[model samples]
Target: MTNQQDNIAALLQDMKSSVSEFEQTEDMGILQRIDADFQRFAQLVTLFLIAERDTYYGYFLMSMAFRTNYAVSTIAGIRLGEYPPVFETNPLILLKYSLKEILYIFCHEIDHVVFNHPAEMMKSNPEGNPELFELFNYAADASVNDMLNAEIKHGKKFMQAPKGVVTSKVIRNKFRLSHVQPLESYQYYFDLIKHHANMLGEPQQNGIAPIPSGSAENNASPNNNAIPGGVATSNAITAAGAAGNINDHAWTFATEHDEPASESAEAMAEAVKELLNEVDSMMDGEARGLMPARFSTAVARANKPPALNWKAILKKYVGTIAADKVKTRMRLNRRQPQRFDLSGTRESKTLKIVVAIDTSGSVSDKEIEQIFSEIFAIIARRSFELTVIECDEEIQRVYQLKSPKDLPNRVEGRGGTSFTPVIEYINKRRYFRDALLIYFTDGYGEASIPRPLTYRNLWVVLGNTSNLSVENPYGLALPLEE
Candidate 1:
């Protein structure tokens, strides 16, 4: 076996030996008892890590520090915000389950982290209403557990979910909710539950009532009676019953003592994001592919880049282009005002820009209109000797527009696309040699366009295509969103 595997096996054996030794001994000191509990908790975490190696959850578990917190009402809960995030659990409580069941609970808690429940709860319950926070926990748990249950049912995972865990199936059946869908956001479930609670006219202080032991709706397994957290009984759904307060979600909002958390909600959310990103980077392609689709979908949504402001980018690029200055003796120069005969000069600045429109079959009329609209807006903001060149395989039409009004009502050319023609057309003209070239196209043409050495060019690719996807040998490629 590999060194890491050998170490894990040795650790497992050591834990077993320690447990046997502790069981046989009758008396132990206070410190010894505490150490024993801590050791056992560490062993349980080690066991979980071994089972989930090379997986996202395994990476998360490796990164976290597991502590034994008997004060925590739940079997376990995670804390974020500070460096090296923590997972605290009641070791004595954890000892109640089989290895598979423990693994299930461990993954369940990780799912909460994966879904960013704590940060979300903080955002949704800013007022920190105890009742609303309770509701948020339920909704979050239902969403996560339903996903886990689905994965389990599909035989994609080996862990068996502990009995009486909060799931969408259980919540839907208990609340008579037929319209609720599976694997939805926690907010969806929260809204439905809150609305239903309000309609029932139940007092918020009393909390949602639990399922009675003898009720037909109480379909929980016989052995699965106790909820993960200490808030409710196995058969109840309220703060005093089964469904509410599954885990210590309040840690995201506050410390264990109910004091406010050290980090702001935004900071905590960012920390969770960074941690997830770190774990994501560590996962290989095969490991990522083995992950449930829900996880992949969530990761994609979380990591999606903010939309680019194409208009601002276009304006910025245009603003940086060099302007040609002309000197005329129409006005007095500030430097030499003493002699009237000494002809003072007036300065005039004009921007000469070439806008090449690809009138190929691939380029739509709407795209052309959008290109014109943006160009017209830019022209209105500044003085320019604007030259609009329409081209496909060759130059179709060229307009020297002095203003927006000078633009043609209709453009020509819808032949096959080739950037070579436009490059040649611009390079051959002495007047256009010094002007900045701006090409608007769908970027479906040849990748090996001839480089323009005379003047700088900018490729404003229209539609969803980005600069990286376009082929331009010289100058910047700016993507224009439609």
Candidate 2:
């Protein structure tokens, strides 16, 4: 095994153990700074992250928990799947906050994954609006804080959402949502906030705001957008005004965390995805039934993965896609037995294909249907092992199609917009070096500067995005008319 594999295996073993038992090699200074009691709290949450995903204890099995450094005052996300679970923590948080509050933070972190707030925010704001991100954190916290099933110490409640955060009651008051369900998904709250904001005549650029859409908040960027450090812009103060006691609880969850190394994060994410898929396999019947109806669907979807197999999506560009070989009648067969005819040397070539699809939110079903029909017409003349990829900003899924019927009935990701992910994905799959890459997208995303045209690339754009002026140094970018 290579160094990467060895490290990951070691990490997994550490994750499977209790936080107390797990070793601390790197962050000795920080760990030493944190109190032992807080370490126990971290261990409890870490164990929860890697808890045995069985029926009786299956509540957290679907939750993707990680034991990473809580460098800032908070913690969350997938990087915690590694060995020797390290829950993010700092001196002040451990000293000041109670275990019950820590539990609340833990539940809040998991809620982000369960509701997929990050992705939804990405879908809502593909441009990466900082204001919206802040709002999302607060709004998400509000939505999650009360919904958790945790109760710590003498029946005291775990969650105590700060006054700055908005709650369901806030939504009820703002939009007169008297009938809004008790346990609405985070998206519901986000939508409610967005719809209300638009009604108030705020700029609806991307058509959504943070918990309310933070990008629009005037106080969003204090350093650049403000007068040096003060809340100079109207947006900043606007954001601050919304936060009842904004300055007090300014620490956001998404921001407080560190950026994991891209390669390791992606690598671990895939591994965790597989492990979650396996755990999900056994989560049928009563175990499944126990989860909240709304929360259950997300896990169910993750586990079952839509039953739409493009040979298990090539079971990640992970399959061999055959293409019709360009052929000409020759007089000889060199490998087996020479076809002796005083004609020409005989040769056989196996062809392959690469198809990259833009599954960005803007691309419609009709677009998928229309584009695929025309593509099928083009490649139908030959026996090609087709590979299909559904992507948005990043590749959401990948699979190899054995036949035309192998077309997937469903797709993943309507989140944001990016083409670089597929480009990078293609670069790694060096084996398909000579395949014809037929890409389908809305033509609304970033592309490589000096385009990597190692493989023949073709872009089939749908909608008005076809009008977009894209400089293609590699191959053709044509509008799919009709």
TM-score against truth, every candidate? 0.48, 0.38
RMSD to native for every prediction? 12.1, 18.9
Evaluate model 2: give its TM-score: 0.38
Question: Tens digits of per-residue lDDT for model 1 on 1-482?
Answer: 44544554455455434433433342223224544545555555554564554345677776777665433445667778556887665443444444456566777788887787777887777777766776776688788878777767876354677666666775686568877788887888898886554432332211111222332331221232333343222332221122223335665533345444324565666767777877777677887777666567667756777455556555776677665544556656567876666666543356678888888876576666666677778767677788888998888988788765566766788887777888887777777666778888777777786667545677777665553334545876657763
246, model 2: CA deviation in Å?
A: 8.6
Tens-place lDDT per residue, model 2, 1-482, is 33433443344334323222312222233333334444444445444433322222223433333332322322223333343212343222222223334445555555555555544555555454545554454456556654653222224342343222345665566456665554566666666565444333232111111222221332231231222221111222122112222212222223245543333333433443454445456566756565455455655554553332222222222233433333344544445345564344433244467777767676676666655565556555555556777888677888887554566665788887777777677777775676767777777665443355444666666655344445653665655553
Query: What global local distance difference test value does model 1 have?
Result: 0.62
Best by lDDT: 1
Which portions of model 1 miss their true places by more than 4 Å? 1-54, 198-247, 253-263, 305-482
Global lDDT of each model?
0.62, 0.46
- What candidate 2 gets wrong by more than 4 Å, as runs, is 1-37, 44-86, 149-165, 172-181, 195-296, 306-482
